[model samples]
Target: MQSSHVDITKKSAYVDAHIHLDTYSGAAQAAIIQLLEDDTLPLDYVVAVSMGLKSSQATQAWARRYPQRVLPAYGFHPEQALPTDAEVAELLAWMDVHQAEMAAVGEVGLPYYEREAAAKQGNVFSREPYVELLEQFVQRAAAWNKPIVLHAVYDDAPLVCDLLERHNVRKAHFHWFKGDADTVERMAANGYFISFTPDITYEEDIQALARRYPITQVMTETDGPWPFEGEFTGTVTVPTMVRDVAAYWARLQRITEQEAAVLLRENARCCYGY
Candidate 1:
């Protein structure tokens, strides 16, 4: 592997566009701190995504502890059942009040995986509630003028794109994205951003995505605490892994590692306004 020209000794040129920092254990977090201090890990910042209101609060705490490195985004994830309307309202209110502190409205999207689970059980469920909840978050993102990190994949991505269009929310990021070519082209045409995970190394599908999307519209992430396979197997997911991911992306895009690092960092800044 070619050594990265991104000199983390002077300054960080890479960013983890999406992660759930609140979910990591204390010891793991300490390891991250040590790596950063030793300049072994060269990441500028991480966009910490929330699962729900409680997770949002904890993520905010992490942000406070690492004020310069951890950026918080509060929202509900779709993997779990939707919260009550009142609870949703409370979450929105919390986000609104802390808009100044947060970076984006994120980790919110339709339950694609849950839908698959329901089908395996011979159950059919409506996505209306998910759409409705996403609408609320989109509206908040618009009102707050904050970028939104989405988990929408495959067929659901089109619907998510519809809502973004309806709401006219332009600064959107689909993290760890997996979708059809048509949808990918649609998103690229709309100038939407996408972030790739470490899977880019071994997953040909993800490699194709990196090849198809313009470098300027791409970023990198570990989605840490969520393990990966390939070269990432068995190792605890950490932000430092992004260095290798960026290098792989550079190879795929036929650009130098430094160029890829700078482009990814700029993409993160543009998406999250950091």
Candidate 2:
């Protein structure tokens, strides 16, 4: 893999606050790990978030193999159908057994996209179960003293905020976040962190959010294997792309790219405790 041309100095590095490493093929995962191991790239760590038990297992394996690069986050993603009661119990048990190894409890929150799609199909979607499940994860994160990575956005953001506050989980990272001004202010007030994807290089809404958001609470992510547009169009999403996000975010915040890279990296380290 070609190294980044971002001119990152030894004083700074980038951390991908969120990514689905388990979604990639084994070969692709190996290639990405190789890039992460490359000192030439200004990348430091990739927080590999899981979709469920299976995904968590895979991510954990990678973390064990490449402890220097992969920081594994374990939890069920909310965009899919609810797992059975027994399955949920099993997953919780698995997470309990591996809690010490996880960076956070994540890829978990309310199902905004799925519910909206259901509504578009003229179907009523009940969010009660997802909310319950999210609360459980939030409770565990609070008890474990771990940051909770979130998929909550828009209207769902406020509700998830309620859970975080109720549990006193201040180290929340809302990855690839999108929300209204009030929610943004609320999250900022709570000292919660949010990450920008490569799309920040082009998306006006995301840029606006970047402008409104406090840079101290900001970080960069790729949510890799999830493609983007603009300059990233047709290119495979990789963790190194966070350098591009940090660069664009610097322009948005009117700071130097190196400054953005250091701030974002430190924010992720603070939030994830890595």
Candidate 3:
């Protein structure tokens, strides 16, 4: 027996923190997409992110097509190979072309997990050039004045932070944060918000991190398409399951579900500049 491709689906009435809807879908219909709402929670919204230069525009289009329910962020994903400056330049041009429609700059950062594992897969991922490319996008974002969604962890977090600080780009959000205590504390002090997923429900380290961090600085996310199974053998994910993330955080903070929901939404708004 073998585990089939993950059938990542959203549960009832939840918000997916991060996802690439373009993965399974294509760019053709990406422009006129209709974001469906979970029947259980029709009022909830989902944040869709672009994987790289290829998909940013379509992601933006999806968000534009459904502004009230979708928040779209654009950028290059670092785990994959770096794209040419010409490609990045085109993306920036696209940004200029549709500045009013973008949600934020995101899905970009050093690939601590994937890049390191590239050795086993016989691939290449040097940090110098990729970092430089990321810096260029960061500068463009700063010039445009939009919040950035980051995909860095641990050591990469500091470098990303340093670059952001040097560039004076203040609105930075670290998704799925798993950096050092000192780094987390520093990020918190700098007013950088870190979001959690359902992983917090089972991961002791995540629970500990949530307990120490200020609720005001902490937020919940689904990171949908990536399900987290706590005690269950194999669980699945969807936007609606974000409520579980909120509940877990609330439980860790000794707060009510309602209060957690309000705070999470506020934190998300603050992070994404919504």
Candidate 4:
């Protein structure tokens, strides 16, 4: 009956922390408002993510529109790739041109697609290309004092951590981490971050993960447009769903949701220098 009825007041500011904005530009602006419209949600900012080199343009534009709220991170996802060296070089050129446009490097890591496993997809799955590229790019970020928003996890998580350590990349956020205990321990010991999305709201494995690690080691995300399926009934996931995830973590950790929200927001800001 009233706006307050839709919004509830929570403690501290809220952040989606990590999201794919370019992929959902059709509803980007409207969704931004919707996610935090409820006073109960109280989102203060969002960390928009780029899934590819080209996605940077749209993502940056949208983030610029909401500079006070959306900070953009750009990169090329290992899930997709170009066919030749020239094409890869073209991508590198694009990154060079837009280096100043992003807050971090991300959504970029190893490929796990079936075709990539059999070489049916060729070199896209090979860590060689992106790993070498990251070697160069990581330094550029350090010179700029920007963090890296990582996508590699599971068996690949350890490798990502290794590179971050070798390059002295201090600010790293691994979204949707499902890595083994050894890897998780390394990340925790190294002070890297892992984000949980709607995936944890229902999945027992993710819930177990939440229980395995302390709340301070976790943050919230939606990985919008990437459905988690337990809920949402096959509907499109949006960054706003991150609110549910924040609450879920608080519940799992047996702390007030508001308290967890505060910690998560801090972690997000630290990763992106917000």
Best model number under TM-score = 2
TM per prediction = 0.93, 0.95, 0.84, 0.84
The sequence of per-residue lDDT tens digits that candidate 2 reaches over residues 210-270 is 8888777888999998999998889888898888898888887777878678777777877
Candidates in order have lDDT scores of 0.86, 0.89, 0.72, 0.71
Clashes of each: 0, 0, 9, 6
- For residues 1-274, what per-residue lDDT tens digits would candidate 1 score against the true structure? 2233443333447888888888888888777667545544567888999999999999999889788688999999998988998999899888888989989998899999999999999998788999999999999888888899999999999999999998899999999999999999999988899988899999999998888886778889999889999877998888878888999998997777777787678778788887
- Per-candidate RMSD vs. true structure? 3.4, 4.5, 8.0, 5.9
Name the lDDT of candidate 4. Answer: 0.71
Q: Judge candidate 1 against the unseen true structure and give its global Cα lDDT, from 0 to 1.
A: 0.86
Stretches of model 3 off by over 4 angstroms after superposition: 1-15, 24-35, 38-43, 119-125, 231-235
**Who wins the lDDT comparison?**
2
Ranking of predictions according to lDDT? 2, 1, 3, 4
In angstroms, give how far residue 13 of model 4 lies from its true place.
2.4
Give the per-residue lDDT of model 3 (tens digit) for 133-252.
789768866887887888989889999988888888877778888989889888878888787887888999988988887676666676655646765236545555677788878787
Clash pairs of candidate 3?
9-237, 9-238, 10-238, 10-239, 11-238, 13-240, 14-239, 14-240, 17-222
- Residue 102 in model 1: lDDT: 86
Model 4 has how many clashing residue pairs? 6
The CA lDDT at 36 in model 4 is 41
* C-alpha RMSD (angstroms) for model 2: 4.5
Answer with 1 or 2, whichever has the higher lDDT: 2
Q: Model 4, poorest ten-residue lDDT window?
A: 1-10
- The local lDDT score (0 to 100) that residue 109 gets in candidate 3 is 86
